[model samples]
Target: MAASQAVQAKLSFLFKAANTQFASCPELSNFYLHQFQKTADHANVPLADAVQRLCCARCGALFVAGINCKVRINSIDASKRRKTPGRCRNRVRITCHACRHPTVTNGSTTTLLKAVASPGLSVSVAPPVDVPTGKKTKKKKLDLQAMLNQKKAPSPSSSSFGLDDFLSSL
Candidate 1:
């Protein structure tokens, strides 16, 4: 289901307020964050990925690296690595100081890049361009209206054939 725009706006405001008050008043920031989570849950709307990563799922506290939470890249265990050398990879772990909950996520290249770049920095990727290949020079656009207006074929099971006819044929 689609999210309500009004609820989305409210969530944005709450997150911003929590972020702004985090340094000066941590309690107030936590309160705002708690409310933000509650509002999203009440409205049955999903939080944005950025916001979800920033907030502590256990305590509803804002996670500022080195402040409220500790962020690190955890290497695979020696035994596990030995069992599967090539498949083993590091994982990004964020531990909440307030709740002592550790959240582990994949240590992808893009995630490492973002962590090393800067704090509170937004990363945006440009839309992919259709490159000219020998087979196709241009991208084909779908006609949504025509597709919607097309008549759908009935299923074979929906045909006007009785069970008695099948038994007789058998």
Candidate 2:
């Protein structure tokens, strides 16, 4: 058991060293990173496996700053986050040079909200369900005057959704 743990720790060290050195000497860093990957795969070490996921599996490049990857911060504030333009959400966009792909991840605020809202804490977090992250989405023009002039429809006594009706019956 101890021997396996030591091997896992050594692999983690190699991963960290490779990450730091990747920007300066990609070839050497890749050598070490690849070594760690191969070892982790053979041993099926969970810690090293998780670390490997942070790198481009194909290129063995570390997801470090302007090196082989880039992360962009997108933050949405709480006041403006519930509806309208204000639905609060935070995202981190990760782009890998090897894959030529961008992946979005939850940012600090989303993580904090998750921590608070987990069943143990019982805090409620309402995240917007349909906001699109695709580049093709056209930005809607906001006209405050037109919005203020719109009429408010009266609420129905019964739920309009079949799912809601089913839950209500229960």
Candidate 3:
């Protein structure tokens, strides 16, 4: 069956169940159904399952789950002394219903939990470059006579006083 059709079927089942469970109140049923549909659409999963997972028995806040879930294996390079060949071992992502913790499933067991610390896990955020404010430092104006005298003092044929010589020095 198509994914959309499966989703609709599951939603209908949840709606009916919710209505029956809530004493068949039309307004309550519609409200619950709307909430279930919204949660399912956001999570891209079955409506009933998503509703069951998010709705806390104690406090009724919708907890977000299955975020930043990934499974990766780093292959060490013998020559370079660095783990370069990073590969994803599993593709199936799972989220815990009670705590909203994301995990990567490998077979029946969850290999990587959402809280496990790993190298290269933190995204590299470049620091903002220092922008020059409107304030400009006052530069001393060069004396033309002094400059000309200094140039004359140096040998003209030597070509050491040129812009190219200054650049090369830098």
Candidate 4:
């Protein structure tokens, strides 16, 4: 398959896996979706692809292990987990498996999915899906009459210096 198609297929798998993994864990899903949105907002990937690549494993910290992207998972102890009130259930605290950095979780996966999957979600901002860039056309033919009319138009100083006189002087 072409490079673009391959990238798309990998992204599709990541999104499908994320959907399946997060289906039962809404909180984890929301957290990952939010992280994906934030990362995609800043990263090199197109907004849509960034969103699609966002995934997490049973433990939080945004999974990208099998995906084409370069995200690394940092390990942390489950004992360090914290509890924040008014948050989604099944919330687990952990650090980056790779970097060992600390982060917090908020109940957001469901909201993220709703926002991304929604038909009305800002279609103008998202990139077009599955259109081959190689097939796109550029350059348009100019209108001959329009070009002729522009050529026929007089210069600003033409009226001050009579056209016939100017031509004669030239």
Candidate 5:
């Protein structure tokens, strides 16, 4: 337990240092962030949700909203989500600008909405269905000959226009 506390203190210090140095020297900040992760891993300590949200999983870079990352809220349709057992109701997507890697974190709708609606943070809602990420659809074979032979609607003739007769009567 003493070792865990030491590791926690070290992690907090590293995280703060990383954030402080990030604006002036990003490389050094990234180093600190990497060290933070390494220390946590070595101590077998799990990172808190608050800490995890501000770090990039790919490059170990500090995530600053709108500066180094883009944060968006993805809401799943209730009916669709219920059909899929493993899917989350609401997902918060944080895309790291440095590596262009997107990390998705699932949470309650109210909490995610509150986080996104906070002042100074830009919020964008994703489409209900992400079509591109799903499986590719098979193209159906078209019967050109059958389509060409199909009967078409008759075109209206000039005699069909009774406006001239109507004007003459008026």
Candidate 6:
């Protein structure tokens, strides 16, 4: 999957470069874009999903950190590190210039970097680089027994307006 992801990223870069070089040639740009998509789809790379993290969702425009997109990483909280220590914190945000589409991805920087770096040397065919929705996920079931044992939050004030109250007031 890493190898395929790397291939797709390379193709994206190629098409982006081509698109700029042949700005006047709309057909050439469209050809490059479609060719990229076709190659990625054939490889089963999920390029659009990967590209969604780094490209414009609306226009399928390429994102260059400072050039075409605004790439920024959210601040990480030091206090609640262990309580929720997953991709939920310190998200990577990519805002595209062409369509003004803002994309927020959790902990996807490493995979993107790996894909870009993979083309230089040997392909990283090993697992670990994964798309957001992969097959390894498991359904987390809540422990009802534990929930019952734990003290619940105090109920909201009873004075709060009810549906009947709002309807009557209206």
Question: What would the per-residue lDDT of candidate 5 be over residues 3-73, giving only the tens digit for each residue?
Answer: 56677789889989998999899989989999999998888787778888888887898988888899999
Clashing pairs in 1: none
By lDDT: ranked, best first: 5, 1, 2, 6, 3, 4
Candidate 3: deviation at residue 109, Å? 8.4
Candidate with more favorable, higher TM-score: 1 or 3: 1
| Per-model tally of clashing residue pairs | 0, 5, 0, 10, 0, 0
* TM-scores for candidates 1 onward, in order: 0.56, 0.45, 0.18, 0.21, 0.56, 0.37
| TM accuracy, model 2 | 0.45
**lDDT by residue for model 1 over 1-170, one digit each (tens)?**
56688988888899899989998999899999999999889988877777788888878899889988999998877677557534446778899999899987655544457566786776678989977675453322234544544524334666665675578699
- Give the runs in model 3 whose Cα sits over 4 Å from its true position: 3-31, 34-51, 56-110, 114-116, 122-170
Tens digit per residue, CA lDDT, model 2, 1-170: 23377787878798788878876888778778778877777776655434644776666666776867888888766665565232338767778887766766555555566666778667655986887655435333334444655523334764565664578799
lDDT of 4 by residue, 30-115 (tens): 45455544543444457443333343322333544333224333333334323433323333333445345443444334456567
Name the runs in model 4 displaced over 4 angstroms: 1-17, 49-170
Q: Number of the top candidate by TM-score?
A: 5
Model 6, range 75-116, lDDT digits (tens) per residue? 657675446545245777888776677888776444455667
* Among all candidates shown, the one with the greatest lDDT: 5
For model 6, state the Cα shift of residue 167 in Å.
87
| CA RMSD, predictions in order | 21.0, 21.5, 18.5, 22.0, 15.7, 19.6
Error of 3 at 92 (Å): 22
Name the lDDT of candidate 1: 0.78
* TM accuracy, model 1: 0.56
